[model samples]
Target: MAWDYKVIDGSEEKTDLGFRDEPALNHKRTRILDACKRRDIDDLQALAISRGGFLTDAIRCQAWPILLGVHVDQRGEQDGISDSWTTLKKHRDEGQVKLDVNRSFVYYPNDDTQAQLDEKKSQLSDLITEVLRRQPYLCYFQGYHDICQVFLLVLPPATRAAAVARLSALRIRDFMLPSLNPSVAQLRLIPDILRAADPTLYAHVSRTEPFFALPDTLTMFAHNVRRYSDIARLFDALLAREQAFTLYVFAQIVLRRRDELFLQDEPDMLHFTLSKLPQDLDLDALIVNTAALFERFPPESLRSWRSVSSSSTLKTVRDVSACAAQTLEDGHRFFEKHHRELIWAQRRDKVLRTAWANRALILAVVVGAGAVYFRKAPIWSNLAWSVPDHYF
Candidate 1:
């Protein structure tokens, strides 16, 4: 099947497509800022829908929370750390979070120093921990830290927590479920979306396990995209629109890469192509295509997966809160069943930390003494150990 790929000229801001030119974008920014200043939800939503998204990061920092339905009044107020954070209980998922955090350098800019990188990683862990602790029911999946780091970069700590909490409870709730069942159900929508948008591409992808969309969906494209700026641009549209809009975006990405993907008849090859996104992707064109796809196949028209509802119908913050309440109740039942196991895990972690500390101390002492003894030993005797036999 032949597809018409849109070639967007970055120099030419305006296109026959819905993309706004510089002057138009600047006008939209003015209107968006006005709407934000007034806390006008309806107007803000209107601008977001019509203009694609907020034009700048400073604007996004304000508009995103509003779009997510975060309380505007709470913007600058520091809620301090959640009480749950104070207790600092070791979560069953902490180990997984640690592993993911160690690799979160992808989110940092290349120019960032080691100290800055370390601080961001540490803060990323703390933010995720606080959110999970406050709502102990939300499961911490592998790519969650990637999603949270986006918020960490944009908002202040307290506001970042609020925004992430709102998102977890509402926008990407399925991904945070106790199991991957809800997330996989969400993943299934990608092909369904594709079938509606581009049937040939859909058929090609359907041949493979749809779980290939997992990393992009779970991480909100934080894992897939290389540039922070690009991901942020994508999120500007994402945050502005309905939660399920991501499905359309994912479909658009697959459709965009159809040429590269079609050659891979095998599922493994398809998975490899889908997993690593091109570094030089035209995000603006992708966003335009995503919006177009969503327009063609609105959520209501799409097939509903088990337990997952249409995102269009689930637009309001109230809807998200209600869903969160139910999820929390289910989580409480889960906690009750596994209470003892969690407690045991926490104790085991403490013991492991102590043992590790002791080993480090012993290693330090051994290394110090070995160094001292080696310094006093004859240089001639040390040569045998230092030099290769061939060299000798």
Candidate 2:
């Protein structure tokens, strides 16, 4: 087969081709996620060691954080796992579990009147106490802003307060970094599922960049999409009713689609099917999805709600978001309304001050000149009028 290319060594060789076994890969991924949820560090560690050869996504999300603190990566270590864990402990140990976890900000007003910022602090303190009394274990749990919000929405005022207190520390920024593990996982899998559904997109990536293909779309479970009850119930009948819960989407999507995408050298049909799913999901939708995952909303629910990071007390994060938005918009509006006037006033002020200073200087010079002119002129006139000793 290789007669003319003797000088060139055939380093690359094609492997044997066969139909893929997808079920087995899915089972393997499920085991990884289950262990992660349980905080079973040892098993996760073992899996990482076993799959060291494979480009690992699970290990980075789960077991990698365990070593996040001790060494390996220092820059992210403090804020990544350690800081989050510390805040979690602080809330729990200081009895902040029952204290409102809140941030501080002020609301905007229609009229420019007295607006105080310190008013909400005490109220939030009380709310935190009430929520924590109900779900104390929610203290160490830091992920999304929705969980605490769901508690606030679902519970009694007293319970809402306590839950708000504990969940208040959850930051939006927390959803951005090493904390962004879930989002990263979901985003990575978006292409996976897309590729499964649409292969040409997958083929372009694989042929050009092997590392860039998506195998599934399950990380969306955490995104908290509201499914029709009928649909969810039907899915439940096939799997553990709770298994398809959006919170468990990472497990379902990635685990399920791994073999379909991974083992299949042929990226046709399946990859093309996966590629067409919508990518631009809104944050509000994300909030709604996660909220539905842990807390089952009434099927006939009228409202789509969200959870937020608390301030120093239990006030609505929506309120805070609104307030902040209002403040920014108001400030912009105020600047827009008054900018020309402000500039005119400033110019007028500079003109007035300058004129006043110049006037004082001119007045002093005039008065001095008048007195000297009158006295000196009179003397000169008299001297000129008197010709020697005679009066002229």
Candidate 3:
């Protein structure tokens, strides 16, 4: 059941360096199709990361579900379940989903009617709602609809929920937390990558934090990249690699603009420049260079890697080869584990904050579930001050 997907009208702009000839384009398409036929995920990933992305949205319709481990049989699984989901408890984030869905399709489908777009928005709303219903614990972020809209455009309706659920769990789960701290933690990786790739440029841009990458990276560039085909092609690589590769791609973008970045001596100017992507983006070069950069400076070698906790989905899940075998069940399992960890982190932070805020009160007494007991020991005094100021 496909809607009026009026976006991809075959007027895809050609990249100067990527797939310049029909034979090359055909070769890439053939490889992707062949990989899909054989269910050779590794080859599919290689093709995705290679020259041109699953060349067209047509090809993406065939290849994307496979990339996310959404099997052919899994299509339409969400169809009959919606009624039941409606009866069950609704997710807390549904209101925000409606708000975001209402504002979607802002950039593409230039010729569709308000009626057609409203239908698309309705479908988008249902798709997001269905996923959230299935996994009520998954927090919703403002830009999540941007990412979901891409899948809705590329995949058939039956498979849309399955594809997006895996994507939400495996790929962008970090952003779906109640707090944006995990997402900010991902932004922290960008500078580490930049520093490793080019010390001079990193030093030049070091005065500013990595919040510049927050918008683009959070939405997987779906929010910032206005062109439909360009973003769809970008997703080809993004879906194929580990989540950390997204950070590397942005880092490569930063590295590519070294001269432009160096010109901005002031941190504010450099940050403002960096926050917006270039008008003339050569996605092919960026993807290729990003791949090379990741190869050279993999995540484990970076400083941020050490800081990511053991339970982070950032660390535990999202390995390309590992994800190739993962199913929706695996995704849910990983998500539940990660969600628990995130909740624990939040609670720990809250307790630390409260303890620090009322240090004098906590210092005066030892309150236990069993009883409230006064403490007058050196150990209590030491413990009271031990709560670090950084946690505050």
Model 2 C-alpha lDDT per residue in residues 1-392, reported as the tens digit of each score: 11111110112222111114545445546776776566554454344323211112222334332311112243433211222222332334334322323332121111222332233344334344333333333233232222333222223332333223322222121122222232233243333433544455445444432222222222122123232111111121111112112322332233334455565455564445334333333322332333333243321121111121122011222232222222222323332333344356568999998988799788999999998887679776786667676443
The most accurate candidate by TM-score is 3
Q: How many residue pairs clash in each candidate?
A: 0, 49, 1
Clashing pairs in 1: none
lDDT for predicted candidate 1 compared with the true structure? 0.68
lDDT at position 115, candidate 1? 82
Per-residue error (Å), model 1, residue 352: 42
Question: Per-residue CA lDDT of candidate 1, range 251-340, in tens?
Answer: 888888888888999988888888776787777677777878878887667675433532312332223223323433343443444444
Ranking by lDDT: 3, 1, 2
lDDT string, candidate 3, 271-312, tens digits: 899999885778877898889999999988898888775545
Q: Estimate TM-scores for all models.
A: 0.70, 0.22, 0.83
Task: Give lDDT: candidate 3, residue 299.
Answer: 89
TM-score of 2: 0.22
What lDDT would each prediction earn against the true structure? 0.68, 0.32, 0.79
lDDT of 1 at 390: 86
Alpha carbon lDDT of residue 370, candidate 1? 94
